[model samples]
Target: MRNLQGWEIFVLLAVVVLLFGAKRLPDTARGLGRSLRIFKAETKGLREDDAKDATKDTTVTTAAAEPVVVEPRPIESGVAQAPAAGAHAVHRDAADR
Candidate 1:
């Protein structure tokens, strides 16, 4: 779009004044300014967060990671027993009732 001339800008402002009235113009402008300021701050915070994430993504760790070893605990019983599915369903139904 072409840049508006001074007269066009003046006419636009005059139209706005006519539409919203002179009394409400300052309040409207103040609200618009506050919204823009808040929007700017949020965008700046997002950019900083993205920059931090980008840096974190590019970093190389020199330390060699150790492999995890998990030891299993022995059961008290010599044989392992699995519960029946029907028994579980029956227990749940009884509890619900």
Candidate 2:
């Protein structure tokens, strides 16, 4: 659409003034400006945070990290193996009552 002519702009302003009244116009504009300012600041902060994360993801660690290896113990037949450290042993007799 083409830009509004002078009279069209005047008419739009008149309509807004009539709808909201003269007294409320400044307050409404101020509130709208504050909202836009806050929105802009938050978006900027998010962009900065994303940039930081991108940098963090690109950096290489100097020291080589070694993978941990765990060996499993062989299970013996016909013997009740005691529970490993920090293991909770459940008694079936208590649950049956």
What is the TM-score of candidate 1?
A: 0.55
> Tens digit of lDDT per residue, candidate 2, span 1-97?
8998999999999999999999999999999999999999999999999998987867666754444444445668977777566454334453354
Top lDDT prediction, candidate number = 2
Error of 2 at 38 (Å): 0.3
Q: Each candidate's TM vs. the true structure?
A: 0.55, 0.59
Worst 10 residues of 1 by lDDT: 86-95
List model 1 lDDT by residue over 35-74, tens digit each: 9999999999999999989878676667544444444445
The alpha-carbon lDDT assigned to residue 1 of candidate 2 equals 83
- Worst ten in a row by lDDT for model 2: 88-97
Q: Give the whole-model CA lDDT for all candidates, comma-separated.
A: 0.77, 0.81
For model 1, what is the alpha-carbon lDDT of residue 42? 100
Best by TM-score: 2
Clashes of 1: 0
